[model samples]
Target: MNAVTRIGQVGEKAVFRRHHRKPDGRSLFLYGFAKPDGVSLPEGNDPVAKGGELRWHPFRREWNVYAAHRQNRTFKPSSAEDPLAPSKPGGAVTEIPFETFEVAVFGNKFTSLHPEAPDPPEIPGVSSQPAVGACEVVVYTPEQTGSLYTVGQERRRLLLSAWNDRYEALFQQGCAFVMPFESRGEEVGVTLHHPHGQIYGFGEVPQVQRQMASAFDDGFSLERLLPQWSEYSVDEAGGVSAFCPPFARFPFEVWLTPRRRVPGPWDFSEEESDGFAHLLGEVTRRYDRFFGRDTAYMLTLHAAPKGCEQTFHFTAQFYPILRAPGRVKFLASVEQGTGVFTVDVMPEEAARTLRAQ
Candidate 1:
């Protein structure tokens, strides 16, 4: 059900997110124009989409008209067997000789959110919460590349570079917390074949973030988060670091810790960005090579606690999906009914397997 098959044929595919809402208010995303590769616009230009007219359907309450030049794709609710089980984890590992760094950088123009998605909310949190930060996405590719050989050092650079640039832009707009995230379909239960990532900027933190902060306190700051991973530290104050915990929910899951104690993505230095990107490539490439084919996983950025002091550490987690090749670990009553996550495979075992490759 990926866009690969949906492309070329044309018509229209609407991606519907029933629970997630935008500030302007809309529950549907109808995508039909399969955009060309290596595309990006200047500061003021938008990517070329299909369709002949640019309009919004009153009945549908969504963007309408315009025959997009890109492929068409429709979105359906992911059946974790329930309408509410929308938390999909994408942590696949593939190494398919991804597009060059330059091409990958511009490739993101195809995603639904343009660099010019209007002005972000001044504060963060859902409208239900009133004031807080904003969130967005950054797709990694047009094809699945979370698995072996698909993403390497060069591609990782582009990914991080795009993130770094976007972070700065958000900061200039009076942003306080910039949360960068990636939601490749494999982990998110996406039926499409497109590859992309996301970025979020906000002036305050969300509720879920406040909870994480209250639970752990150790002079936790964004900078210190990066270094935590590299040193595998139980305590630290700043720089770049990464760590794989023994209590990981998934065997291959990794937590990236930064050294500085900043609020969000904009805190990164140029060299730090490059270094982090390379390190990310190293870690993910191992996973991709280990999987041998495309892999499934999700990456989430945790930086700066919301509506509080910057005492929280910045950390990103890599959540992989798949109990084994051809055998997926589905969430039964245990996970669905309760939040208790059962790690079917041991963390050591997964790390060894990944390292061996």
Candidate 2:
């Protein structure tokens, strides 16, 4: 069984949503400009996968999830076997049941975390607990081709709205930290070719988030930092600004944030959200245009923890892996071992090149 409902409007476009339960009991959500129709709920059952546990990393003071099951997850399947594609009416059933939709989000079949995760087993000298969290796949389109930048502005707005919905829903479900990130291209180890992103609802604030909160508490100001890097500013529109930080750790690293911080996407006013969607598309377009190809990069959203909203600033950081066209910047011993990144291109140079694009 399935149900479609109008979830209000994002800008001038009307957004409709539908909820479905896969045969294996995983959750699936469909969002589009129109109310989805002719939905087919397939019968039969698949084995439900188990979730993993989190272990304490004593030296790093962080939790690491151990999900051996993830080894069997789908990896670079052929176009015909793309599991993210919408299920055909009488053909093989995939994640989505409908033949078409603007954007689809579903519980990851090979998630590293789970809501019903079992308690961790006792291991001598290791502190462990249930990896009680959530992982989801946010499909940008049903076409299975093109990048998020090619999805166009209307779809991008819908995507941001979908993300906002998920962020709020996850927080209400007890997620301490909710992150929506995209790992694009093969260089970033993206297993799927589809234009999609993932959202991870961590049970606790991760190390970087904790550090960011501390930094903000110490009076580290984005307002001050923006002026210092004014020369590296790439684009600004609708209250959102994208710029390369002077201390950029990657070659073409760019960060996008609102002029004024507001905890997360959920707190964004209508204008801020619209501007964010537009600037996000612009930045990705510039990256592809500058490199003359689909650039591989890590796109991450950093928001305040559930209760520490006022103390944190929301930002989106894009770390493109390419130092130059057709060349990849690999994280070597110095970076992985010592957490010190050696950037090949200066922020000013990279910004100038991107601006020309």
Candidate no. 1 TM-score: 0.55
lDDT of 1 at 40: 16
Q: Compared with the true structure, what per-residue lDDT tens digits does model 2 show for residues 1-357?
A: 578888768877789888887778887888888887755646446675657999999998999999998998889998887888877767776777777888999898888888888898899999999998899999999997887678887888899878988888899999999999999999999999989999999998999999999999889889767766779999888888899988899999999988786778878888888788888888999999888899999999998988888868899999999999888999999899888999999999999888888
Q: Please, what's the RMSD in Å of model 1?
A: 14.3
Give the alpha carbon lDDT tens digit for every residue of 296-341 in model 1: 7777877664344446655678776766665566667987766678
TM-score of each: 0.55, 0.96
Name the best candidate (by lDDT). Answer: 2
Local accuracy by lDDT, each model: 0.46, 0.87
